[model samples]
Structure formats: structure tokens, C-alpha cells
Target: MGCVLSGLKWPRTPSKDHVTPEPLLPTLGLTPQQQQLLIETWELLKQDIAKVGVIVFIRLFETHPECKDVFFLFHDVDDLKLSKELRAHGLRVLSVVEKSVARIENVTRLEKFLFELGRSHYRYKAPPRYYQYVGIEFLSAIRPILKEKWTPEVEEVWKVLFTYICAVMKAGYQEEENKHNEKTPTMKRLEKSQATAM
Candidate 1:
């Protein structure tokens, strides 16, 4: 069951091209005026997503000692100290999705980006399921700082963002599987031909 679940795709990439078209405004069940207010609130918080990333990393390491090895592998760091390039890369990635948080606009481009990201993540061998854990931790870290500014509208935006990201990863995994399957056919044929010759 774990293997089956793990095989399922989750998108980890964010794309600028795929904006959620129908804005998350409606999902919050708020009036247009209220939605506008929520958008403004999100704008303010969005600027801090990078900062939130730092806090999330800290809290994650503090709570999950065993997980430190995974982080080290993914980040190429024996300790918590992140390099400037790594920090910049993280901020850039977060910024891409943060820009999409206010609305549900472009689905296709977003999905593609996420798919690529998921495929890339495989190199680090980070547990595929850890995406959700990171998302939850990110929200938890920022929620308090956001205080009254954190509206349902904002949360809805995050939901869409995460959902889109996970979808991409799911697709990426399937693509990987398909590629492997393609190779297997040739390998099996070769094995059968050799057996028959013997």
C-alpha cells in the first residue's frame, strides 16, 4: 500500500505561465470587496514567503532530527547553513508560486512547471510524500506572523497552489514510469533471445 501510494504523482514545481484563471476569490465565499481586501492581505504576506522558507527549514530540522539526513542530501549541506545560491534558488522558486496565490488562472503551464520540478527532485531522493509536510509546515510558520491578515481567501489560494504542485509531481512520476517501461520491453526481448540461443 505504501509503495502504491508512493508511486502516485505529486507536483513540486511552480510555473509563471500557468496562472489560475478564475481567481481563488470565489472559493473564500467572500464578496468582491472582501476578496479585494484578502488579495491585498496576501500581497503583503507574499513578500515574506522567502523568510518563511527559512523559518520552515529551521522548524523542520528541530522537530525531525532523523530527517536531517534527507535535507543534507537534498541541500548538499552537513549542517543547517544554506549557501547564498541555494537561498536565492529557493526564494526564486517560492516567488514564482507566490505570484500565483491570489488567483486560479493558468493550469497548463503551472502543471508543466510542477512536473519538471517533481522530476528534478528525484535526484535528491527526497521522499515524494514530503511535499505535503513542507506545505503544512510553511503555512504553520507563517500563520502567526500573518495574524488577522490571514483570511480564508488566502488559505484557498494556498490550497490551489499546493494542489497544482502535487498534480505536476504526479504526472512527472508517471512519465518516469513510462520511460522505464519502454526500456523494459527491449531488455526482456534481449533476455528471451539469449535464453533461446542457449
Candidate 2:
């Protein structure tokens, strides 16, 4: 099932790398059953959200060391579990997931929120490619808490949910990047030169 969904590639705009069009937001693609599963599973995960958050980031840093550099606060930290900063940051991320789950039924609102989040991430120098990693780590962290409740169907729904979130966020990041580039002096000069040449 994962392999089948794998073929549903992230939509990309022609202008830049993985920048999707803002107006045409992607669908959540989750059925009623899937949404219910997410809502139910989320209740169980929420009981240990704080612990799960720490575990998620630690596993992320372990699997992808480059991600650690993104968090300047965690740079000098020797132990992630003991780091207060890590705990706080992990909780903040879990909060975003909480918000997303709450807005699952409202696609437009969810997209707008995630889009703004992506724009913020762009400012933080976090790339869209890394967004998927969070989803991966999130699934890993929740598995133990969910235990028997975790099934292939539940996993598929979570994967679909993350895929949609990451896609919208990537679009938002690209839009912000485009705005920043347009404001650059080099871009202005290049545009002027091109106009004069024409």
C-alpha cells in the first residue's frame, strides 16, 4: 500500500524546486474512515505527546544529522533527551500536529495554516525536503504508544496526511522565497537590463 501511494509524487511548479501553485491547493485525499482513524489514534498519542516529541527529534537527528544543524540551540548540546531546548522545541512541533489534526475536516483552513508555517520555515532556513522527515519520525514515535492500535490502514492514513501537509508547506516556502528574490537588488538590475535590451 505504501508503494502504491509512493507513486503519488509531490506536485511542483515550473518556476522553482518543489514550489507548488498557491491558488490550487492539494486535496487531503483521506477518506472518512481514515480521518476517524487519525482522530482516534491521535487521542492515544496525545497522552504521551511530550515524550513522543522528544523521541521524534532525537530519532530525526540520529537518522539525519544535518537536521540537527537546523536547530542552532541544539548545536552544542551533547544529549538531546536532557536538553530543555529540545524538549520545548519538540512540544512546539507536536502542537502543530495537534492543530493540523483539529483542522482535518477543513481543508482550506488547514492549507492556509500549513502554508504560513512553511513560509516561517523558509525564514528559519529549513528546506521543504526535511518536512517529510518529520512525518517519518512522527510515525516512528507514535508506534510504541499506539502499539496494537497501529495497523497498516492507520499507517497509510497518517502517511497521506503528512504528504498533504508537506506539499502545502513546500508551496508556501517557495512563494516566500520568490518574494525575497524579487526584492533583491540583483533581481531588479537584471530585470531593468533585460527590459533595456528588449
Candidate 3:
């Protein structure tokens, strides 16, 4: 690891001509029971995906204040109150989530979609840990909607699902980073900074 900028540690920047690596993660499988829980609960929540999405962002930003920098769209809308743009963003995110959950049974397509998702998120410069926090906040946000149905089994299933999702996404991020590392520009920047610091 090296300082990305302003001494904020980041993985070393890569060269421009670097080749993209093969997928860094194996496919993750969910049990039929786990898939059922995620799909069923998600179907129940889709009716108010906006509300749940709003809650997810609110709770996520509340829990992780530093995460706001990653979103240029919502960068200025820092508070819990949902701005129109924030709401729209939330809607888009949840809509995607809804679609992804629907594809849970089709692991091949799901992983491919998630890899694309990871690349998009990398463009936002959002770290993988933020995804983890979002996963946690999702469960918390949905707990009320689920009411009595939010059982231990449900919680465990979601947690496992998020882990799998994040792993694949991180793999995508790492693949990009590897390509970046093969570039000269980033390497020059890193070397110059390290030299000055020394």
C-alpha cells in the first residue's frame, strides 16, 4: 500500500498498459433456503423500495459519515433528510437491488452483473468496506418493515448474501486496480510523492 493523495493510504497506483487480471474470486453459492429468504423478503419490500432505499442511505451515512465523499451526486446532501436527488439515487439503487435479487437463482448472470456493478462503484472511488457497511445498514433498515418476520434465520441469510456479493465486487475492483498498476502515469505520481516524502 502507498499514500494515494494527502497521505490517505491506498493501494499502489498501476501503469496505463497493464493487462486486466482474470476474475479474482470464485463463484459463491447460496443454499436454496438462503435464496428463498432473500427473494421473499425483497419481494415484500419492493412495494416500498424507495422508503427502504431512503432508510438505507440515511442509516448508512449516519453510521459512516466519511462515506459521503464517494458520491459526487449526493456529496453535498450530507444529512439524513432526503433531497430529491438523493431519493432518486436511492430509488435507482434499490431498483437494481430488486433486479439482482430476482437473478439470485441464476448465479452466472448474477456474478457478471455484480462485476459490472463493482467496476461502476470503483469509478465512484467508493471503497469496499463502505459496501460492507451498506450491507449492514440494509438489514437494519429492513428490520422494521419485516416486523416479526425478521428472525435470526433471516438476518443470518442476508449477512451471508452480502458477504458473497461484496467478495465478487471486491474482485472486480482488484482487477481494475491491477490494470491501473501497469500504467506509467500513476507509477510516476506515486514515485514522485514517495521520493518527496522520504
True-structure lDDT of candidate 1? 0.59
TM-score of each: 0.59, 0.82, 0.77
Query: What C-alpha lDDT does candidate 3 achieve relative to the native structure?
Result: 0.79
lDDT for residue 34 in candidate 1, whole number 0-100 = 48
Question: Which digits, one per residue and each the tens of the lDDT, describe model 3 over residues 47-80?
Answer: 8788888888888777777878776677676454
| lDDT scores in order | 0.59, 0.88, 0.79
**Arranged by lDDT, best first:** 2, 3, 1
Off by over 4 Å in 3: 1-23, 78-80, 186-198
Query: How do the residues 7-61 of candidate 1 rate in per-residue lDDT, one tens digit apiece?
Result: 6663346477754342121122345654455457567767776677666666666
Rank order (by TM-score, best first): 2, 3, 1
Best candidate (score: lDDT)? 2
lDDT of 2 by residue, 1-198 (tens): 556655877443454555444456688977778888889999989989889999999999999998877887887789889988899999999999999999998878898999999999999999999999999999998888898998999889999999998999998998889888868798888889999999
RMSD of 2: 8.3
**Which segments of model 1 are wrong by more than 4 Å?**
1-42, 73-86, 99-103, 185-198
**lDDT: the better of candidates 1 and 3:** 3
**Hey, what RMSD does candidate 1 come out at?**
11.6
